[model samples]
Target: MKRMLLMGIALLCISCQGIAQEKKEEKKQFPITKTDAEWKAELTNMQYYVLRRAGTERAFSSELLENKDKGTYVCAACETPLFKSKHKFRSGTGWPSFDREIKGNVAFDVDYNIGYARTEEHCATCGGHLGHVFDDGPKKTTGKRHCINGAALKFVPENE
Candidate 1:
């Protein structure tokens, strides 16, 4: 029947759209790129896992959680300034939480690795996976919580 044939074609077109989206994500390119071997040589195993492979560190395992010093957090891979010390907060989520990032230094994307969409944040310069952002934050502030992996960042003290 012509109706049946049209339905099948429509289904095929819908499936093709899904495939195209996956391909687009696979081909994403960053401004700063390096060979896998070079990244391996330059980073520690944990840093490589978190930054280059889009991996998450264990909760409550980062020393930055308890850090009270004045400084800025930079991307471990590219040294891009991410969050300032003043913006950091205790979100009790076992990760370094920030009220915001330095404008234009961080980039946002969607991740579905957990079978749901999450707002993924990354280093704009190197495209390293930083972490996720949420809406539950201080009401007087940006109302954004940037829950970042400490391994994906390097702290630079203000005095230094």
Candidate 2:
């Protein structure tokens, strides 16, 4: 009886571990899936680094930082519409900051790559990493700051 009880408990523990591992390995499917080689061919060095590899660009190095034209920022990898110029605000965070994103165009996930939890943003259609969102934003707006990497985006003027 004791042997049977011990074996049952061990089996339960093993099954529970499998369940947790399965959940962890389950990845979200993006509509714009591509092979890594294809992505490398399509994106520039910085764009691949920031969007595909979840890397950050140097602060204040993005030309989009000073762009004030009425335009839409689209994902560099998939050309998915992301942020609009109208929703953008200068958060002085050395990155292109926006008060909001085009609704349902962006997705969020938690990232602990920096040793702390951060609200990481991704292009909903392509699953390319844009940047992180924070609560410290314009009080008059959504109170959320979508701090995006300019390299991960391509600006399309309103006329286009």
Task: Give me the candidate number with maximum lDDT.
Answer: 2
Candidate 1 — which residues are off by over 4 angstroms?
A: 1-23
Candidate 1 TM-score, true structure as reference: 0.86
Model 1 per-residue lDDT tens digits across residues 27-133: 56778999999999999999999999999999999989989899999999999999999999999999999999999999999888998889999899888999999
What value does the lDDT take at residue 86 in candidate 2? 96
Model 1 C-alpha RMSD vs. true structure (Å) is 3.0
Query: What is the clash count for each candidate, in the order shown?
Result: 0, 0
Q: TM-score for all predictions?
A: 0.86, 0.85
State residue 61's C-alpha deviation in candidate 2, in Å: 0.4
Residue-level error in angstroms, candidate 2, position 133 = 0.3
